[model samples]
Target: MSNHARELAGIIMNRFDAFYRRFLDITLGAKVRFESKDWLGVQLAGRQRIRLYDHHVNETLQAVRDHMGGAPLGQEGLKALKQAFNDRLTEHANPEIAESFYNSVYRRSLRHHNIRAENLYVHGFIRRATDPDLTPYCWQYRTNTGALGDCLRQVLERLQLAVPFSDLTRDLGYVDRYLQDHGPAELRGGEIGLTFVNTLFYRNKGAYLIGRLEQGGLQWPFILPILHDDQGGLNLDTLILSKDDASILFGFARAYFMVWCPVPALLVHFLRSLLPNKADYELYTAIGCQKHGKTEFHRDFLNHLHQSRDQFELAPGIKGMVMSVFTLPSFDVVFKVIKDRFTPPKEVNHETVKAKYRLVKQHDRVGRMADTLEFTNFELPLHRISPMLLAELQQVAPSLLSIKGDTLVIRHLYSERRMTPLNIYLEHATDEAVQDAIDEYANAIKQLAAANIFPGDMLFKNFGVTRHGRVIFYDYDEIAYMTECHFRDIPKARYPEDELSAEPWYSVGPSDIFPEEFATFLLSSPRIREAFKQQHNDLFTAGYWRQLQQNIEAGCFVDVFPYRRRQRFRFLYQQGNDKPGDGASPP
Candidate 1:
């Protein structure tokens, strides 16, 4: 035999000896004797010695080969077969003591392989070969003869071949070639097994010194001694800790169990890494009513917030209150641990606290007030402009912000201060400025309409301006379909005729609505209106609105007024002023 084959044979022999000894101990309640010449001999305490014949070793090897799909035995396969042989020997010698051993192996193997309950192929084979349905005797056989038999049968079936010594050798050769070509380099090392912890830290982390330990790589500093011995073999659980304390004593347990451990330790570690010795943000709480649900909805929302606390940097606060409906008695609110800190406005005094916004009880008996609080600043013309304005416009500069469900999260901006659309004209003295602003705003509404988004509470107070002067829509409750929108030629009186009421609210189709009047409602100022008509007269014409209405109804979903769609102009205006090139600036 070649050196590798000799090594393999030695490993097989050592495994057999261990199995034989363990079997003797369990069955006969005595240790087995071994001859140096590959001979296995067993003895009962009060009985004559029983010399193990070659048939026993031959049969076990055959069974193991059969179990491994007739493939050559890898280190893991060899270890398992050795364990099975020991179990079987114990069972045959003393069936009474064999039950526990058998059960332990059976349960472990079943769990390790994730064998489903519906896998009747193996179960059926065992049932046909044994009595009492193989269920009661499953444990005893599993430890000893049964595990080997099952493995052999499974391997043979997997290979779709007859069970024989010759076929087993042939299959092993095939498996050897397959592994030689395709197996990972690390796995090619003799008698070594791959594990995530070892590979992750050693190979990927470039920690070559630690890699030499192989399986010991997973034995972290605190967990090594309990797992290994002076001879370097693993020490079983019984020798390490008592059954009750075994779970508590282990430092690095299974991956799933490690995940289940409390997150506070990791959280602290992360915080320490980011801002060592510095104080962290305090938690804050906000309360509001569900648009169309009960307290359960509110509870679920709180749970979601708690689970994503790390993402939000939220700290803990009070329980607040639970409400059946949005009312004064049932409403509750809590403050976050962190203080609301923002840069003070340039005009504000350093020592004075500016009351920029207010947080109030959701159910306070304010007139026409909903449970939600309005976040605003008086310096910005938010109330006079649009309620659903962009975040950038509300501040001093432009910013990109998005709404996560009900909460607005600003991002990709240096500061929260946004520039309003009105501010765009305040600094410049362009003649067609007001007309340009109206056109931009009109185009924004048209885009929203084309997307089937009907702003139910479409009012100036609801919109905001970004630093870039682009309008942004934020409110979700009143967001609906353009198809559900209705427009009147003139403002409707408080007491309108019943003929104006559209019935079967859900039956409204996209084709039934007209959105051209949106420009009139949106640009209500007379000065701005006159400017829009003068500069863009076609904007107010019926043909323009009609064509827009047709495009929206057709559901093209394209932007009606994209920034790139603006008409190119050579000069600001033709006011016969001797300004260089007659108002035409050089490109």
Candidate 2:
């Protein structure tokens, strides 16, 4: 039995190495894809990368089952297997991730009751070692000896990009001026240093150079979004300074960045230093290791449960017809389970709902959709669950839950970052805040549409407000691709009775959507209606949606800046180019 366990551990490690190599191979193509401006290729690569983990896990699960002769490993066998796995991980570059892969294999190969430290890596056992001889993942630069502009030039030159900058001198001038005006006061005459990640982070149509600026004892995280201009030249689109804005750039709403790192653990460590508020799991997920992130989250959550006494209760918001959500008050994540039966008007089955969440996982979120971590055979202690919440779950999603002893096993569920539901947010918001949320709500719709996604149900309850005040869509039960939908304008009323009828007189197909009726359901408040009309009146017309569909069909990639427009140095430079007091600067 011990020999077989050792052999199984070796096989799993071999499988992990293969997966890691393939992951890096796919990640390496991101740089070439960005240089060639292959936006479609970027999307394809993203979907493929996201699918890799599960593909390998399923394959390894089959291998493990075959090796074990399709029988469960008893406690002694499981203990021996875990020990062998840990023994093989001593010098591993990413032992935490490898342990996670083992956990996935164990979880899928056995029943839920088999979950234990003896069989799975419930918590990380391998401590990361800092090798003195290992190469650093960041390039360090000192601004103390040279002009800031000179140091910036060296940083750009070090990238050794496949394409040349559009106008390095001009961009440097803009950076200099912007820093002189908006940068920290201490940066002007104080000693400063910059540390940038060695590899560029690629996602969608943009590449970002992530770094930190240090002066005195303070550190400010910064990001430079590099873009390919219309003239086929590379240009730095904007400079993002401050931790708040940097965190937004890495917000849970955005798609993962494709970053190739030889030493992923070291890279995550470096990123943590720059974004201290971000968790290790978030940093790993942002860099495209979502499976590992899920593992880290599970470990952290269990640890929190052990430390805290908070009970799991129903998440505060309008009840979801398709998903039953609950959370621990002290935690920032919500666990969502698909109900056995959805409420009327939902019209979706369990498999379909899972498919929609899968779609969200594989699609480009464009910073307007939340990312979810899917899990199966998850368990929780029944005692920690509030009685009210337990009764609610048993009522709606009983099919997904089973009470075995003191443990409640969830067959499957998704975990997502918690945010204030948009409807709940608007209830207490001041007039000004309501107006801002309304505008942001409209902008979220436009951005999702631009990315070729249509929120099938655009009610306020379907969206959420992030900590940064950005609105994002969270409901996946009623989402569809823009190209998959048929946008249509309502015909003029043929009779007085037709005008007053609650139901439309015209025939409607499954894929057909009437944009004209959107305002009726979306804008109930007069203030919200007027504010939405001021900025997004065109959203109510079918023409706007049709144009977006056409653009998507033509393979046009829309520019969606993660940062605000005013934060862009190019716009500021354009403002300066215009004559003073002329008011000719672009919005």
Which pairs clash (backbone N, Cα, C closer than 3 Å) in model 2?
none
Query: What's the C-alpha lDDT at position 102 in model 1?
Result: 29
The prediction achieving the highest lDDT against the true structure is 2
The window of 10 residues in a row where model 2 has the poorest summed lDDT is 578-587
Q: Compared with the true structure, what per-residue lDDT tens digits does model 1 show for residues 504-575?
A: 223445334434455657556665666656534553444544554566576432312111211111111224
TM-scores, one per candidate: 0.23, 0.95
Q: Provide C-alpha RMSD values for all models, in order.
A: 31.6, 2.9
Off by over 4 Å in 2: 68-72, 111-113, 129-135, 185-188, 576-587
- Give the C-alpha lDDT of model 2: 0.84
Q: In model 1, where do residues sit more than 4 Å from their true spots?
A: 1-432, 475-477, 487-524, 534-555, 559-563, 566-587
Model 2, span 1-587: residue lDDT tens: 37998998998999998888999999999999999988899999999999999899889888888887888777888888888998899878778789888887887777444577656777778776554332467788777623767887888888889999888888877777777778765565657888888789999888999988887788777678898876679888777777778888887888999998866778887777677888888988998888888988988888888999989999998898999999999999999999998899889888898899999999999889999999887889999999999999999988888888998989898999999999999989998999889888988898899898999989999899998899999999989999999999998888999989988888899999989889898788887887877658888999989998998898888877787776776667765543221111122
Global lDDT scores for all candidate models:
0.28, 0.84
